[model samples]
Every structure is written in structure tokens, then in C-alpha cells.
Target: MTYLLEYSDYGSAGLLIPAGLVLIHLCALLSAFHSLQHVRTSQAAVAWVVGLVTLPYLALPLYWVFARNRFEGYREAIRDIGKEHDQSVTSIRRELFSEPCNQPRTFQSPLAQVATVMGTPVSQGNKYRLLIDGIAFFDTMLWQIQSAKRYVYASFYIIRDDQIGKRFADALIERANAGVTVRLLYDEVGCIRLSNRYLRRLTEAGVDVHSFNTRQGWVNRFQVNFRNHRKMIVVDGRVSIVGGLNVGDEYLGAIPSMSPWRDTSVQIEGSLTRKVQAVFAGDYYWAARADLPEADWQRKTDCGTTDSNDPSLQEEPSGLGAVCTTGPADERPRTSMMFSAAIGAAKERLWISTPYLVPDDAMIVALAMAKARGVDVRLLIPSVADLWAVYLAGFYYERKLAEIGVPVFRFTNGMLHQKCVLVDDSLTLIGSTNFDNRSLHLNFEVMVAIEDRAFICEVEKMLDRDFANAKRSNGSNRPLRPWFARAGTALARLFSPVL
Candidate 1:
């Protein structure tokens, strides 16, 4: 009423001021209603509603950037691509699965064999092992890229324009020049600084390169909240390398601050590699809107392993592995479900390593439940701080988990950038997912769940070494941070749902 009186007492400009305020308030109310409908969790929805209703002036812009719970324009179509001789390519993005991808096979447009990442068929004789560090990961990845025969599909979150990036770009260019079909996908926000020269060289060499267009234009640039954070490279649809190492010199310990980068990637060779390529095909369709040149998807069940009764050779667990991909487009929060299900299935021990550990209430409860079941649950995070807000929020979570008797080990050897989870003695997960709301609820992410005892032993040995070098903090006897840092944590946690 006071605002109305002020507007009425003044001239036309004052009247417009009140109208603008009303418009802003109306937009906030609408966004609040959207939050109620779209936000995955009740806790996140209520937080947005309270802030939006109370502080529309400050909250509206932030809401525009971060509060969109779904990636609106992403598509799941697997086009029936032509052969390698096709001269041109065209693509169109569509929202095919308007709900949770429960019936993923129904998405088979004209390519029925092109599988979704929901649940790949388990097969035998697939050999999967870990690449322990950046050196091993890159050495194998680059060699495969250089030796591509039919096609190469590479997707990553970040591709820096440095020595590592040049070596990667040169490999793709060289392969393209040699008549190998090459497709490259990088996150738009992650490679926002990627120069035109770098991309131009690839295009000129006849390589199909596209950014995962999470953002449309500079006018709405902050819509970078959604990202395609998948790191995968498939050569001839036979070999796939999936994990955390990005195309950057820092990943190789070139930077003094982040020396000795610690990460892990898995290379699977056999029919299962086709599933990883399918994930790339779906993402490529969304970004490039064209069909990928067809490659061999023939199922071979007995290739990578020999049928032998010797004790040394008979210890394999049939190489059971399944792949799952998740993102904002799905109606249900699949990433959270994926993580919770893995946590629930751990009977003996569960070891998780992530650069970030900002879990939600449900995740806290999941950890508590795991501890109650006597599962040896441990979390490994980076001792160093990359993003202050996320790093600080981790302390708050560490304290909360400590209350439930779970301990966190901080890696001191280098930055712990691996998103890996080893469960008991048979299952392991590796890919480009962080344990935060953004990665679990918002980003387009991928992880291959391997359930082979042989592969699990490999992952266990790697994590054993990682844990051996880490510093353990129970968070019960001592403060994780000083009073000022603790105060910062309170503020940091306020943004965890969006972080």
C-alpha cells in the first residue's frame, strides 16, 4: 500500500516503477511454482521457494542461471547414420524421452542395436583393467587415437589449449587425414576458452568437432549450469577409455600447484565398448544432430580371455560390466539413484574417491545406513582446495559423516581427481561424476559399472595405494577447520545444493 501511494503521488515514471516491481514479484512466484514442480528433492525445492518469495530482487537472476532443474533441449535420438563414404552431415535435436528412461530400448528410432546407457547387456570375455595415473591413461588413449581404423569418438569435459591439448588435437587431425572418421565432443563451458585456431585445424582436417552446447549464446551465458561431464574415447568401437583425466597439462602434473595428479581411467576391449560408444552417439546427436558413421557392433563373447583351467588364468569373474549414463533430461534423478543403489549393494566394503564430497541429506542417510550394516565405507578426497566453496562445504559433510563414525582420507600425494567406487570384491565404478548435487542431479554424466572380480581386484589395489598415501581424519576429536573456516563452511553449505 505504501508503494502504491508513492507511485500515485508521483508522475508516470513512479507508476512504471510499481508495475516493474509487480512484474518481478510475479516472475519470482512463477519460478517458485516451477521449483515445486521440477526440483528433484523436497529440501532443494523448499529452499528455492523461501528465497524466491522473500528476496525476488536478488534471487531472480541467480534462479535464471542455476535453478533450471532440467536441460530443456537435450535429445536422445540415435539416428541411422550412413556409411563412411557420405560426404555431408546434418542433425536435429529432439526431446524423445519426455520422462525417465525406463524403456530405453523404445528409443531405438531406426537403429535398434544402438543401446542406451541405462543397462547394457552383461557379456563374457570382456577384458577391463585400470589405468592408474595420467601417464598411463594418456599413453594408452593417445596410442589408440593414432591407430584408429574405422572411427574414433572422443568426449571430454575439459580440453585445454596447451601441450597436452595440442598432442590430443594433433592425433585426431592425423587420424582424420588418414581417412579415419573422427568425432570430438567437449563441454562448451569447460572449453569456452578453446581457441578458434585449435578447432579450425580439426575441421579443416575433416574431423567433426562440436562443443556440447549447454549454453546458447552470450546473452544467456550463465546457463552453463548444465554440463556434459563425460570422458570417453572409443576407437573402432572396439576399445574405450573412460575416466577423469581431461586434456590438460595440469592433469599430467605440469603445474607446480597440482603436481603429481592422481586419477584413474578404465579401458575395456570387447563388445562392451560398443555401449560406451552408444553414449557418445546420443550426446553427439544432441550436439551435432547427425548420425555417426556406423561401426562394428557384433557381439563377441569369448575373445579377450582364454578358456583355461590353470589356477592363474581361472581366477577371472567372467568380466561382468554394465554402463549407465544420467543427466537433467531424465524425469527421475537417475544419478542419485545410481549412487544410492551402489552404496546399498555394498556388503563388505565400499571405498569411494572423488574430488568433491558434498552429499545431500539422502546421501548422508545412505552413508549412515551403510555404516550400520557394517560395510567398511571410506571416502577419499583431495587434500588441496580447488573451489573454495565446494571444498569448504566438504568439511561440513565430513563432520556430519564423522558423527556416524565414517572417516574421510585426504590424499596428499596430489590432487585426487578420480570418481571411483569399489564395492566389496566384485564391483567397481569409474567415470566423470562428482558426488555433488550438480553432478548427481544436473550434469550429463557417464559411468561404467564393472562387476568382475578380476577388475575389482585391480581397482582395489589402486585405491589401496591411494589410501595408503592419504591422511586420515575422523573429524570427531579435532576440528576440520578453524572458527573462521567453520563459519565459511556454513555459508558454503548454503550453496551445496547448487554447487
Candidate 2:
């Protein structure tokens, strides 16, 4: 044949071409295998069909690399067994009591209007308490956990086995041991350093613990990016806590590393608690055993009733009341949309505090437009951030904001992990929704849109306290070695999407 004659004309042609092809094919196969392993099972199935139809030669190599190479033999066997023995179960007759959420009288609660505008009925009549600071938030939350009589359900992005976390775990265990159902869920990646032995102790003590997006075998390596970043605590179906604060020494400012962990959370009582329960339940389905039993966790509680002028509804009126939560699993959570509405509705001033501020395109546009409309926009960030990559990525926005009359300040004392937004001395949003792309689109996060003047004023006071110590940045405040720094900053900004 002509091709056979051409191959014969070259020296070592038989050896080189096939060898090179095999090597390149192996490399591509392995890379594709590893990438596919990181994806979900459903995604892997689709990828399998594509590879089989278009590149049949790659099918076996891809499958072997993805399914066999990454996991230990023993863990693989255990995970296979678990896939069959998942023991969660729920009865169809289980009474899941939940009332509709409070209606947004104004634009303060952004999502409240979405259903209404679509001709759907948005429930109204829930009560809310706009809580501030870690101590006030956690103390109130722990009290409710201790008081939980029927069942306790909670989850967080981060959970340390420290004092605050220990107290919470102990309370849940106590209730669980007393025949009150207790279930805890946390993100595996976020709490990677957290000891399973410690968690095992809680389990032995009676608490049911689960990790979100976690697997025991090779597939575990692939699911590291997706996390349940939402912080929530639903107690006895009557009360719930959701907000920015997580279970850590840093969150409590009790650890030496974080001397003053400034944060916010909200405790909800009334119709809103049921909505939070739904959010928690949906997450439980994804993270825990899908067959887990659902009981009628809802109960009647006299504290913090949904009365606009109730004396107990007043801040800390011998109780706690508020709401904060969002997640990608939910339908149209729209964290960014809620934030935009809050910013747009600002009548007097807008103040924001966050550890990271890598705003996405929409958030950047919203802030700029708010400034154009004459809102006094301000931002507070840590002077020395734990994550410099994100810090630098967010720095360029300071210059851009200053050009448009929006002031940005960096705190010098400690890491400012508090995620806060205060608007018009009337509306405030406090929770885990950072001004970043991950929070807006990827991570499960929570925030409360409060229309209470008292709470907003308190948030403004906190901002004022932070501003006094922060180093203000303006057009003329560029550092001395400006060009090199600017170049480095620009490079960082280019990769900001993933930071």
C-alpha cells in the first residue's frame, strides 16, 4: 500500500509514532478522568456517553483513571456498601407545620415581592429580630438549643470543637439523649481540620452528625469545591437561627488568633421559623441520608409572637427573633438580587463591612449606580487580611469607587470577618453573604433584610466604630511604590473571578 511504503521510508517510524500516540493518549485520558471525577455522578454519566460515542478508545482508560486510581481499596468497599444501606426514612403522614413568610411592606425584603409580582401569594405575618455582634447572637441561640424539647436541626459551613462549638454540640447531645431528635450537618471541606474523633464522641453521646457533599472514597477528592456554607439552627420547629456567625473561636473572639470577632446573626420566632425549617430540610436531603425520618417538629411557643407592637418583640425582650438564610438549592434565592434591592432602596447612606469584597459584575454595577444616584456608599475591610489574594483582588475596586465618590476604608486592628450592610438608618442586612462571586452564585449563604430603625442605628454605630480605626483610601492615597503594586494588583484582579 502507499501508506505502508511511506512508513517504511522513515527510520524508526514503527517505534516512534505509535509510542508517541500512546503516551499522548494516556496523558489526555488521565487528565479527562481526573477532571470528570471531580464532577457529580449525573455529570459523569453524561461525560461517559460522550466519550464512548466520540472517542471509544478512551472509554476504558477514562473509567479506570476516574473510578479506580484515586481511592483506597478499603474505603471504596465501605462507600459501596453505604450506598445501599442509607437508613433515613420519613412517613407520608408526618405533619410539617410551616406558615407563609412575612410580606415586604416596602422593598426592604426583595424576594418578598418576586412571588407577588408573578401573581403568586407571598405569605406575610412572620416576626424578625435584627441581631448584631457574636455574643448577643450566640448566647440567644444557645439558649434556644437548650430549650429545644422535640427536635434540633442545624448546619454550618464551619464548626470548630472549641468552646462555643462544644457548648452547642453538648446541648444538642443532651437533648438527643433525652429522646429529643438531634441532627447536625456541616461542610466537610470547610471543617477539614475538625476531628472526626471529636464528632464521633458527639455521635456516641447521641447526636446524629452528617457532612455535606462528602464521600468516603476516591470520589471525595472531586467534591471539595461545593460546600454548604449556610449557617442555620432550627429548634423544635418553632424557632430558628441563621446568620453570618459560625462555630469557631474566631467567631466568638474567644480564641487568641481572633481577639474580637465582629459578626451578626438573627433568631426567628413565629411564621418565619417554618420557612427556615424548609431551608434546613432541603439541605439535610442533599447532605444527609435522603431517607431520614421527618417528624412534626413544629410546636407552639408563647415567646416572640408575631405582633408589630408587642412588648416582647422589642430587641432582646427576654427572647430572640430574626431571619437570615440563602442557598443555591433553593428556587431563585437571589442573594445578589436581595442585596441590590437593599442598596437601591437606601435613602440616606449605605455602609458595608466584609472580610472579602470581590464583587461580581452585577454587584459592582449596583454599587456604582447607587453612587450615581447620590447614595453615600462606604465600605470597610480588614487592613491585613488572612487571604491576600482576595484582598488584592478587591483593592482595585477601592480606586474605582473613590473615583465615583464612594469611600472605602481598611481596618487595621484585626481581621474584619463581619459581613454587614447598613442602609438609610432604617434597613440593615447582617449575615454570611459576602460581597463576592462565590457567595452570590456558588456558596450557600444567609442574610436578614431588616427594616427596623433601632437595629439599623446599632449597625451604623458599629460601622462608625470601625471607621474611626480604618485607614481611608482616596485618589491621592496610593502607596509609594505605586506602579509595581498596581501591576500586581491588576494581575490579581484578572483572576478575581475564582478568588
TM-score winner: 1
- The residue ranges of model 2 lying beyond 4 angstroms of the native Cα positions read 1-131, 214-221, 254-258, 291-325, 328-333, 475-477, 480-488
Off by over 4 Å in 1: 1-15, 76-120, 216-222, 302-317
lDDT (10s digit) by residue, model 1, range 413-484: 878899998878767889999998789887888887776676788888889999999988665568746899
Candidates in order have lDDT scores of 0.78, 0.64
Question: Model 2 — TM-score against the truth?
Answer: 0.71
> Which residue pairs clash in candidate 2?
88-291, 88-292, 89-291, 89-292, 89-293, 103-124, 129-321, 129-322, 267-322, 268-322
Inter-residue clash pairs, candidate 1 = 91-289
Candidate 2 per-residue C-alpha lDDT over 1-499 given as tens digits, one digit per residue, 9 for 90 to 100: 9987787778577789898878766765665656465433454556664674457566655444333212222223324334653331111111121133433345444333332222122322445565566788878888888898888888888888888878878788788888988888888878888988779988998887888764444645443334577888888777777777888777766765556666667776664566566556655655553533554533333222245576544544322223444444334436666677667766668789888878866777878888888888889987765677787777787777776677788887666787888767555666677887667655667665554445556667778888898887654655643687778788888656445
Clashes of each: 1, 10
Q: Local error of candidate 1 at 242, Å?
A: 0.4
**What TM-score do all the candidates reach, one by one?**
0.85, 0.71
Worst ten in a row by lDDT for model 2:
89-98
